[model samples]
Target: MISYEEVQKHVSADDCWVIIKGRVYDVTNFIALHPGGRQAILSHAGKEVTELFSMLHPSDALENLPPEACLGLVDPNTVPAQENVLTESDLQRRAAREIMPPAQSMMLLRDFEEWAQRVLSETAWAYYRSASDEEHTFMENQDAFRRYFFRPRVLVRDMSTGSTETTFMGIETSMPVFISPAAMAKLGHPLGEVNLTRAAGDWDIVQAISSNASCSVDEIFEASSEDQPLIFQLYLNKDRSQSETLIRKVEKLGARAIMFTVDTSWDSKRTLDSRAKAPTSADASSATVATLPVNRAISGYQDRNLTWDDIAFIRKNTKLPIIVKGIQSLEDVEMCVSHGVEGVVISNHGGRQADYAPAPIDILYEIRALRPELFEKTEIMIDGGIRCGADVVKAIALGAKAVGLGRPFLYANGTHGEEGVRRVMEILHEEITNTMRNIGANTIEQLKPEMVGPAGPWVGANRPPYIKQ
Candidate 1:
């Protein structure tokens, strides 16, 4: 049996070891190759990481570890008794789990969000809810959906013919809506991305696995059943070789598409997240606890110089269809089309990257107007503040091939695990069906440009400045 003293001695980049469930693992070689990056592993090097490791990894994850990496068990007598530290976050987690509303009773997506906020720790809530800078654009994303009014036709016959069934990037889906890639789902639930994969399989929707997901890509895929459609969202790393390796792995694992996120070259300034860590009178008793930094900023080999050249490298590396996510302008769309990309996800990182970034919905209209032929050639997707079924219809009418929902699913997973996720999709399914009935559309194809109107002359403050009234 190994001693804890021996493990503690090797805690640097060159030689790092960790204790997991009484077993020691020499992760020196695995550090740089880690999907979440080296720091994530290095932070807990030489320390007991059973709790965090179990929460983030699958049940069989350790079995895949290299045989040589396992350096035997720690002596029960020499190992110190595991401390059962109950901090405020622990209390909040328990409280959140205790207060989860029955999945059957959750009627709306907003219901899950409300309960998730109550249960999540202050730091997690801040990170999930916080937007960049003043959050003007963040609020605008939701409001953009409301700005467009629906022109419903009266006395529509054969409403039963309507169906939300559609295909995205040649992948059949129950509805036009799909789950967007969001990171570190373990912050909300222990199941993390596994919950997302299970729910997507249950409901026949596409699941875009984030590169930054708490669960490894293999773990998420392992939980999925055959015929369940999955895609990968990639953040190009500074190390080109590492990026190439990741792409090949995902391709081999059967990801139908790759969404290369190009917007987040620089990190956004999340002030509320900073405040949650700062000392405050509201939680003076737990100031020391909060100082432990519950939420770590997403860091890794982020390439600030990621450009079109890297796109060429990715195309040559894998045959998976490439979708350039985070496209905000006509110029970028043209560039993506010029590069022969299969699709484009018109997004702004859900308005998390910049304060005044243009809404994806607005950009969607601009793209349709400028390059109408490109829509026929390239599949267009949009995501940002899509809170309801009518919003889904509006996006389709405006020219988006499909829509993505990120934060809502995160809240769903936190509130009710896999069932919560299924319920959120169920809620959207109902809303989309009801919306189709009311709008007099029979099939997704019938949701044409004529069914929607301009935001002009609207009598709401949320309306854009260009729109009157």
Candidate 2:
């Protein structure tokens, strides 16, 4: 058994050793291959990293390392007791949590975001809230939804039996809204994506598991019921064999579909996240200001050469339905249909990848106007800037099969864990039903394009003439 003193001697980047859950590992060789960057591991070299490791990775993540890396267990007696010193941010977060409103008081989806901003750490808040560059697309995403107005058919019929139930890629769901895949959920809460899984299973809604999730596929699946449908969102690895292994693993684990994210060929400039100090550093001002942003650090291994031809590679590996996510333009949507893609999520990566990318709602409008037939050719879904149940109703009216949400759920889960997520779902379900009832639609099929129209005369312009003045 290695002593704690022995571990401390090998702390340099050239020779790194760390203790994870009492087991010692010499991770010198694996540092270069680490997807989250070498600095992420080097920061805590020669230290016990159980707490930090558990936050960002599953228990079995170290299994991927070579056998030689396992230098056996460290002597428990030799290890010193860890100090429980809290930072100023930690004190502020704790203080905020004490005075925060109860979960039931959060009636709206945006309400959760307001609380999350107050409770989350600077790094976590920045990571979830930041958008690319000037965040033009980010702000525009929500603004675009305001461009349309619902035309309610009053006194048509007494509608108390309206249902939000719908099928996504042939799987039945409680509502048209599904939780969109987001990375590193543990940053928000300790249980992370597992909180989402259990909540989704309980509520009978779909949950798309992220490739960069803090929980393992086995853990997320185990948290779900046997028949609960789950989708796997993939970021293709540069090493083809690694992705192949992952595809086979998820298929065996009962993932019903694969959402291949295709927009992020390279990382974008998220100024907020970049400006926030890295959590791994003790002295953020000196140690981490110049380090890579969280997005780039975790996404380094994602294949930058990803193309349309790579779709075939995924098709050959699994029988699961392929849904191309991050389709931004009509031409790309047509290409997806031609390729026989089972579905497509019209998204701009939640406005986190491209600075000025068009909002998903606007793209949905373009598709409806130009190639309406494509709606029937493949399942059309949308995400980005969706905040309320009315937004869900509007998207359905414009031909979206279902809607997906990322940041709202992230904020909800961040603030209140599983209960926060369930509350958001509950609020959305109520909102969708209310909107449907008011609009004289009793079923998902009744929502039509005619029910919605462009808002006023200044529909597509950046701002109204009066605002410019």
Candidate 3:
């Protein structure tokens, strides 16, 4: 068995060398999953693997290698790319000066207070981050998870048996780390929706495309591979025909689900938006957010008069499962559940619509408790302040099946396009795996509210508030 110290050394590529004939080369990443077999990797475990690689074997032609390549000795020609790539130190020297990000995540709550005071355009900061003041509901979200706490049974049998398969809306998702929708993606990055949706395909994560995207719905769906699951987000259009057109197009695109964002009837008055005068994040491509005809022959309409009936209208137009977003109260949850809603996104519209609205996580349990019968029957997803795997764990434990990540992703999409999103997702994935391993929970379903506990100090007894269940 590899000891902790050995693993560290191997990971750091220190004290370990690769040997070929009489030479040495490092193959750290390839060590564990070496196609040449564990013995070949072990052969160079403590030395260099140069001569074996330099021999110009079938491995070098790995791109043309057959499926059987994985079952035999090292192809020698198949030397790992890490063998020739620049080392960490080499890359470090060439890297640009570190520029701290303008926005912070929930993980950096300790620095949150500092971030607020930093001089940034109010609109940028607000739209980018900033939930409402008293922000108690928002703060309580973290606390709520901390309170449930995980309960792992010792010596108990793990019935999971390594398969974390779960089905949602007739589609199979490995786990619930699906995509969250974003508005005016171009405001955050160049490729915008294109970059994000494509990367989602790489990780097998579902990407919910936004209605306000610069790229039209058709383009966004086209960007994804055949295997990816797509969910089209719906925002009520000023004209019902616009909404109708959008829904029909989304259905034609094979979207797995329909998400109707209902939290914002009136535009939110974010202090950030008002103070900063941020640029229009919405796409300039179409005057409207829906798929209606752009012909001047048609007159304009208004979304201000939307009602619950519109939900039914949108549903009637599409065959996909209908999910309502932004349900904060238990009453609303019950109302939607009774309306034959297939899913509910418990959100505060990322604190953009209503200042001081209860954070989505804070109200999640109430929603869960309100519809115990529909809990497993209907899908529940959430977004807003989802930064790390811990936040993801907290969300899942609070009953979120698939969590949507917003601002941070926008920051990434703008910061480095696809690479930035890939990096961000990678971090979240690792954190999710690490969190599960640390807490002794493997799959998303196995994650429970119990994994979280009180932060630093809360000596006082808990408040006897009304819990939905």
Candidate 4:
């Protein structure tokens, strides 16, 4: 058994040892390799960091650390009580328990978000909420949805026949919505991606699991039934072989599709997440901070050399339908078509990758205007700031075969576990049903372009004519 004193002796940067759940981890070699950065783990070196570690990481994260890193368990008699070790998480957990509403009362997607922010630890909240530098594109994603106005048809006959049911990439779904892939679900709940996949299966929807999911792909697949459709998102590493192995594994596991992400060549400067990692007060500059908490998955195995040739390699290697996510340029969409990609998820990495990037909906509009015929060939999808049912409707009307919702589902899982996710799907289903009736559409196919038009602040606004000053 290890002792606190033994752990303390290794606190310097060169030989850091951290205590997590009464066990010691020699993270000296791992500090620089940590995705969150070195200081995040270093700050908790030699401390009883079980609670902090649980809050910020998944169960598998500890397992992923080198086996040799596990020095030994600390003697329980010598350590403080488990309750004392969990002081921070205990407080947050209690607050969450106090504020959470009954599942039935959560009527809208935004309600889940409000509850999640209230209950999640401050750092977790910041990590989930933070966007790229200046956050302009993040704001734009939500605002762009509001700019489009829907034209509701009056005196519709046989509204009961309206169906929200649709198929995405030939996978039957209750609605035209799918869960967009996001990383680190453990920050929301212990079950993490397990909870998400289970909820998606229960509701007959698709879930695109992130490569950096707190839970591994095998674990997530185990939680799901054989018939449940799953998609896998990938971030290519420096080693092409690693990506190839992952592709082969997911295909073997029956993942219906592969979303090859390409927008993030470099990590973003997310101020809120960085500030969350900083010492609480300016005077506490000397405080131990084991990690420099950057946005999770912002800067990791992403290959800078990712290009069309790699895409071709992936396509040739896997029979699974390939969807190129984060396509914003007309040229890229044209290229995707030329390469015969099965699909394209028009996205900007939820505005997490780049500042001032065009919102996915705006990009969808541009693509529709330029090459409407491409939508017929490729299964087009969009995700970013899709908060409610109307947003989904707008995307479908604008030629998206499906609309992906990321943050709402994550917040749902955070606020109330698996049940929260179930409620979110239920809410979206209701909203979509209501919206289809209002728009006089009986099916997803009935949602035509003429049913929506530009609205709100930018309706008729254009660049002001410049005069010589």
Using lDDT, rank the candidates from best to worst: 2, 1, 4, 3
Model 2 scores a TM of 0.93
lDDT of 4 by residue, 1-469 (tens): 9777677789888999888877888999998788656666766667788876775565667876888999889877677555645667668768777867787799989998888787876666777788888899999999999888887887866886768889878899999999999887888787888999999999999999997787878889999987899999988878789889999999999999999988877777776887776666664766564246556434566678777887888887799999999987777888998889899998988888888889888878776666788888888999999999999998998889999988898888988889999999999998988888888887998997767656732233321111112
Q: lDDT per model, in order? A: 0.83, 0.90, 0.59, 0.82
| Candidate 3 local lDDT, 391-436, one digit each (tens) | 7776776567777776666666654568667766677776776666
Q: Residue 99: error of model 3 in Å?
A: 5.1
- Of 1 and 2, which scores higher on lDDT? 2
**TM-score on alpha carbons, each prediction:** 0.86, 0.93, 0.64, 0.90
- Candidate 4: misplaced stretches above 4 Å? 32-36, 56-58, 61-67, 80-96, 287-290, 296-298, 456-469
Candidate 2: worst 10 consecutive residues by lDDT? 460-469
Better lDDT candidate (1, 3): 1
Error of 4 at 234 (Å): 0.4
Q: Pick the candidate with the highest TM-score.
A: 2
> What is the lDDT for 373 in model 1?
72
User: RMSD for each model, in Å, please?
Assistant: 4.2, 4.0, 20.1, 4.7
lDDT string, candidate 2, 1-469, tens digits: 9999999999988999999989999999999988788888887899999987887787678888999999999999999999989999899989999998887899899999999999998778999998999999999999999988887898877696768888889899999989999998999999899999999998889999999998888999999997999999999999999999999999999999999999999879887997774444566565642556779888978999988999999999999999999999999999999999999999998899989999999989878766789999999999999999999999999899999999998998899999999999999999999999899898898898877757865345622222223
Instruction: Put down candidate 1 lDDT per residue, 306-401, tens digits, no spaces.
Output: 888778889999999999999888788889988999999988888888778888888876665556677887899999999999989988976788
Clashing pairs in 2: none
